[model samples]
Target: MTLSEELLMAYDRQLRTDAETPSAIGIERLGPLRLVTFAGGRGFVTYQDLAGASARTISHWVAEALAFYRSDPAIARVEWKTRGHDHAPGLHGALLDNGFEPDETESIMIGPAHSLNVQVQLPPGVSLRRVSAERDIRAMSAMQDEVFGVDASDGNADAILRRVAREDGMELWVAEHEGAIVSAGRLEPVPDTDFAGIWGGATRAEWRGQGIYRALTAARARAALALGKTLIHSDSTEYSRPILERYGLRRVSTTTPYRWRR
Candidate 1:
């Protein structure tokens, strides 16, 4: 199958209609999809089998789902993660009609585990390793928030702590050069799936294209494969998109998140 076809099938089988695993907290059923409510009063929608839904069905689902989120006072913001190949008939129109403004459309990059798992030559005075220390985790999360342009969040740190507390098979990796963190990423080995997710990859502004991000990704990929994951996936921005492309990760689809704010 082509990348687009695989994308559609994946979303159908995994995201929209029959997502086997929901987010760790605050998920409610909205028809066939799960409406995810997370710590920051943020709502998310995901499903796996939306490829076959008719235009009218898609229309109704979108309207009803927005209404459900809109009625909830605690939901200060919401994102409907729409995949590029998903047969979400009239979804764009419906979302625009409902005041959900589109955010950046990111590349849905996916590929074999080995392709991105190559060794990286870290600069002298640089080190890479898995981190579990509470202080290190907080600092790393704070750096991520800064890079992503969000305020430093205790909730984010708390969640990392919770993950560490549970020993949830989630690994945080960071690269340090000259006694400071230069790049970092997370490896999430999804339980019972051949896939692992590479998320929250961030690099300091001065360290942008010196193979640090790729090295961080390679480290995560190596770890994932060691744990028997065959596939890797990420929602990539333009910066990292080119790097992943060079590593044989195809842009299987696009995910444009539409956010609704109170």
Candidate 2:
């Protein structure tokens, strides 16, 4: 197999379990699906594959999964994560029929952490560092929410603060210009794995194309390397995909989230 193919297989085997469900309040299994409940009334569905089930079987699974989430009064929203390389026939139609709406697809980028640990020059007056204080974490979360086009909500900040309190090997990094956050991302080093995920990468519109995000990514990469993580991965949007590609990460697969709201 090619290097990219090998890496993709490793991702499926190593990273697609309860390891992906950190901070989850509870989890239940249905066939290959992991029904995860988070602290903020959010549910999530993901799996390694469909277990070679037929199209009709997958459709039935989808319906059953949605029903499971709907039965929970506390679950206000659920996201079903689909991978492009899976044999999940009829999943799209089934999810839509069950009131799920698809979000934009993202490239699953993977590569050695060292490939991204290069020196990146930030724009003038910009610096990068790790943040854990509640005020700094809230500011970072707010900026990310704005960049991602979501309303600035206290729930997000609260959720992050709770994770910070847990100290579960998750690190938040940000680039600041004159004491204001310009770009931010988080490093999650999976327990007992060779991989660390760089997630929630965002830069302000005004700061785009100035390398702030790249620097933040590199800083997180260096942190991962220090922790003995050999591999780095991310689900990257178009704006950030090219940057990661240039840093030697391969687009191993694609993932799209189907969201259902109550």
Candidate with best lDDT: 2
Candidate 1 lDDT tens digits, 1-262: 8765774455345433323333446677756677877665778887764747787887888888888888889778888888787667788888888888999899988788899978888777878989999999998999899998899999889877877787778899999987688888998787766678898999989888778898889999999989998888888999899999999888877889988887
Q: How far out, in Å, is residue 199 in model 1?
A: 0.7
Q: What is the C-alpha lDDT profile of model 2 across 1-262, one tens digit per residue?
A: 9999999999999999889889999999889889899999999999988899888988888899889988989999999999999988888999999899999999999999999988878789999999999999999999999999999999999999999999899999999999999899999999988899999998999999988888899999999999999999999999999999999999999999999999
Clashing pairs in 1: 11-48, 12-48, 12-49, 15-47, 15-48, 16-47, 16-48, 17-48, 17-49
Position 67, candidate 2: lDDT: 90
**TM-score of model 2 (CA atoms):** 0.99
Q: What is the TM-score of each predicted model, taking all chains together?
A: 0.89, 0.99
Q: Where does candidate 1 stray beyond 4 Å?
A: 2-22, 54-56
Q: State which candidate has the highest TM-score.
A: 2
Model 1 scores a TM of 0.89
The 10-residue segment of model 2 with minimum total lDDT is 115-124
